[model samples]
Target: MSDLNITHEFGYKNNPNSQAFIESFHSSVQREFVEYISFNDIDDVYNYYMSYIYFYNHLRPHGSLKYLTPDFVFYLFNDNFNDFISSYDFSDFFVSVKK
Candidate 1:
């Protein structure tokens, strides 16, 4: 890790709350996706996660984000907020899920 200039940081000792968000995300991924599939190789795992991440950020609406996709909220705040608001179309921002 040192040779690669990578530094690993751990949560505060015995402070589970410090890692709550990541732990929750891990649990969600395992329960919602990983449990249902078998990976053929490392590349397959990587490809699966890449698509899943795109769906998670761009298509899936998060309750914690007021039912908005993360990509929507991210651009809403990072871009010119006022311009984004003025040109916003709610119909395009949401995706319909099929049962």
Candidate 2:
């Protein structure tokens, strides 16, 4: 369903957690696109969002992910964190200490 249709069907609720997440997402959007770019129409806005989503998930490097794209980390780890721990060099984070 379209976002407009959803808005028409549902009334706003006083959900603080939902509101906080939405506010954070909007702040990121404002900083990333709305501040520097202008959309020509609904199509333009949709296309821009699609491109941004691809870039954000597949191309952009995140600090929290240690400068890796979400897709890269997702596929590499693939829910098998044990393999990641065994294969990847974590020497920087894990040091052998002499007691």
The all-Cα superposition gives candidate 1 an RMSD in Å to the true structure of 5.0
Badly placed stretches (over 4 Å) of model 2 are 1-25, 79-99
Worst 10 residues of 1 by lDDT: 88-97
Q: Choose the strongest candidate by TM-score.
A: 1
- lDDT tens digits by residue: candidate 2, 6-71: 543332587555566556667767888778679889999989988887867666666678977666
Candidate 2 weakest ten by summed lDDT? 88-97
Clashes of 1: 0
In candidate 2, position 41 carries an lDDT of: 100
Q: Please report, in order, the local distance difference test score of every candidate based on alpha carbons.
A: 0.81, 0.68
Model 1 Cα lDDT, one tens digit per residue, 1-99: 999999987898888788887877888799877997799999999999998888787777888899988877887778577776787666756677799
